[model samples]
Target: MQEKRDPLLNITTASSIEWGPCDPSVITNPALSCSFFEIPLDYHDPSIGYGRLALAKLNATQDRLGTVFLNPGGPGGSGLDTLNMLADILSSLSGGFYDIFSWDPRGVGSLTTPGEIFCFDSPDEYNVFWNGTVELTGIEMTGNFSDPNDVHALLAQAPIMQAKYDELARRCLRHSSGKFLRYVGTAATARDIVALADALDGPGSLVNYVGTSYGSLLGMWLINMFPERVGRVIIDGIVDPTLLATQETATAFHELADADKTYEGFLTGCALAGPQGCPIASAEGQTAADIDATIQALLKQAHDAARRNTSAPVTSEIIRDELLSVIESLGQAALFANTTWPMLVAGVQAEAGPESLTARRSTRSARRRTRRSSVSQQNQTRSYSNEAILCGDSIDLRRTRMSEVFGTVIAASRNTSEMFSVVWPAEFYACPFWPVRAVERYQGPFNKTLANKVMVVSNTFDPVTPLPEAEAVAALLGDNARLVRQDAFGHTSVSEPSQCLNAVMFAYFVNGTLPEDNSTVCEVDTDFEIFPGVNTEAILAAMVPRKIK
Candidate 1:
């Protein structure tokens, strides 16, 4: 009998993309198209199975320069969703001369895809996993814990937290098939991009691409893996692959410092805005320093109230979490500042009466619960796949003790702001108990110079990926890459309001022009609204220069 062939292993490439109308609900534009492309789950072992990636494309309005691939970060962010939302603006940014493409990376998108990374048996079960015993039984998973006694109290809960992580790992194994878990690492995903590039632009052609945030990691891996295939690539909001490749507990703390810097930026910005501009600022002609003191006092009061188990409307933990959240939304800080500043003011201004506090707490709790439910529904597999990818990519955390990890992080946080310290390190706690790893992880010689020089963008005050990491990535890529530093505050420079950065990117992607200065520093529009609403026209207009300088 003849040996049977794996049908999915057929690797012939010839423009397999078939574009058609996207769902009107997803994208209102009639100009865009959507399609699904089949790729192997494990590129090295094609016999394992095949997976389909959902992709969205917008044709160039003018003569096509080439295809530009985009990834919006979130080792789990839906590229298709991002492309649908930003297609028009991105097209204009490219000078209307390139077809833009984005997709849902393997292990993400709809569960209908073959070998999707399923962790829970059902959505309801996933919700319980998020909001139940594990969350409620801890010493309130996050807080500044500046007090030594408070730090010790959190430390004491390590055993309980460890048990919860082990249980979660076991549940993931019980609920999800093990075959696909080994195939979702950044390296394996990079292979899928290679295959897609071959299918779309012919085998081994240079790839025209733009990657942001976690997406920048994808770009780095792509160039290192296939240097000759690199085209005019721009990696914005760089994540240091070197740190990611390590197992050090201190690495997490260093990451937290990025957020801490952005938090300080928020306070400074508020002070500069003044009492009339910043809701949190006292109207008594208080300086930024005075306002900072007042906020700290309110936080201390909330912390004391929570320790007493009083019926306060908000707790120190809640305030800490909200502050961290606002920092994360620094891309839209102006709008978030408008909302969160008022809430902080309200919390500080509330009376000490139990009935009054209880009523306000009840209303806030209801709204938060509703918002959490909606977010959980939308992000059904985000947490699962994020853990899966991190665990699958890094040094196994199973060998490390949770107590040691938490202790190191807590100690490190003392040197900086402890506000975001507790929550940031908590993410890696489950890594020690993760169930699987990729079969062929890419341990890199990232220092290799590429066939084509690439462009990198970074913000001086990014809340997530910091400036130093972007510099490190550029250095690692040797002299082949240029780093553009945007003097701004946000996680990613692309989406944030910056005409100079946009002009730089447009010149590179459209005209193949590199900045004259290797390490160029660009300034943001001072008067630009960080929290500009969803008016795409206004955004595009802002990007387009009325007169070329």
Candidate 2:
């Protein structure tokens, strides 16, 4: 009898990628090269066939040290796209010594397999489903959980959100291929990293890499899965592995603890910059507290309109979501979308009032009248890779009830900020509804004895990935990891355009140096004035505004 091979899978082979000119659609960087790997869908089992990943590399200009892999988070984020935009700058940041490589991780944005993760059939399907949801439309019903009336009003809608999410779970399952979806997660991607390292730098070569936000989680998985393979790894904007692996997506994770503090910093920065930069800033000694109060008043006015089922130019949910976005992008938000802080504020002035928005309210109400079950929906060639990857890694929450979600949301309000909590459902609320789980999810033993000390960089006031999470990871990894906190706001240290941060990173990668343990604090380019003015060099060196969040 002849030995039989698994028909669905490919045998693990020693493979190498051929770098060639990238397609104009995928990546238009003429200087960079593009290629891919035929990686096993299941690393441990060859029965799952092979999946392809799209990769891009920027070769070093000077004497090459080695290749350094980079991931820009999102769990589903496209490193290939990031490389295209920041190729020159990142190459320079690494001192033009190491080849910078990034890729479209499985199921993310690319024509590569497992393909783009989608819960729906098209943008129209999503827009229709989103019609009845609070995420798409700004919440006018209540401002926050301040008054009992508002709290009750918010809680009453919890079941609706839950019901909508439950249906969402069904649609995702109905639309997505469960077999391939299971492999489109971190553990497999981690294996792919090692495999890519093998192909690019010869088998078993130490992996040099940088990851931010969800990418940091992938880095942790990579380091732990192949401890000795870690060469020069930096995980910036760290995620709380504890919350990530075990908890359901929306259960008051530690990541949001500093969100409000980061927001306060934004308000203060606006006041400091004055009216020229921040529209809502007071000219007469306007304190951060005063600006916050003005925002609160605006929300209240929006709430009154919402109470009457009226539509304003901006709703409470929209403003609250924007608040969260601002905190996540405080550095880049200094000049976001060609609109400064003041202009954004002026737009949300509640100038039109409730009655003025009455005409718009009728149209909004008519569109929202379509109930969930009333229309039959179909799937589209779309992707929500973040949801797929994140929910798969997390412990399942199908058994959860509305009360638990309600309590969690309420407690989350206390934990982060009342305004932020209202907009929480947008990201992780549907995770419980995510039916697919990964084939392999790395849960614990994050403190593996690595080949080197993993450098963890973070912003002190990071809204999403907070500094304490970085501290905890550093403490957990013990001698295997070192933590460096840049005294700045936003999601990651690089967003602040700090020379100190960049120099420290370069030194660590090039010279194998970690900053003095607790004493490491890089200042923002704005405060110190020590870096002179924000020049082209500084902007290029710092992270591109599109952040890891």
- Candidate of highest lDDT: 2
**lDDT (Cα, tens digit) per residue for candidate 2, span 108-151:** 76456886666776656776786655545644434346568766
Q: Rate the local accuracy (lDDT) of all candidates.
A: 0.66, 0.69
Q: Which 10 consecutive positions of candidate 1 have the poorest summed lDDT? A: 366-375
Candidate 2, 318: how far from true, in Å?
Answer: 0.7
- Expressed as tens digits, the lDDT of each residue in 188-234 for candidate 1 is 77877777777778776788888887788888888887787888899
Pairs clashing within candidate 1? 397-432, 398-432
Query: Model 2: how large is the Cα RMSD against the reference?
Result: 6.8
User: What TM-score, computed on C-alpha atoms, does each candidate reach?
Assistant: 0.85, 0.85
Q: Please report how far candidate 2 places residue 160 from its true position, in Å.
A: 3.2
* Superposed Cα RMSD, model 1: 6.3
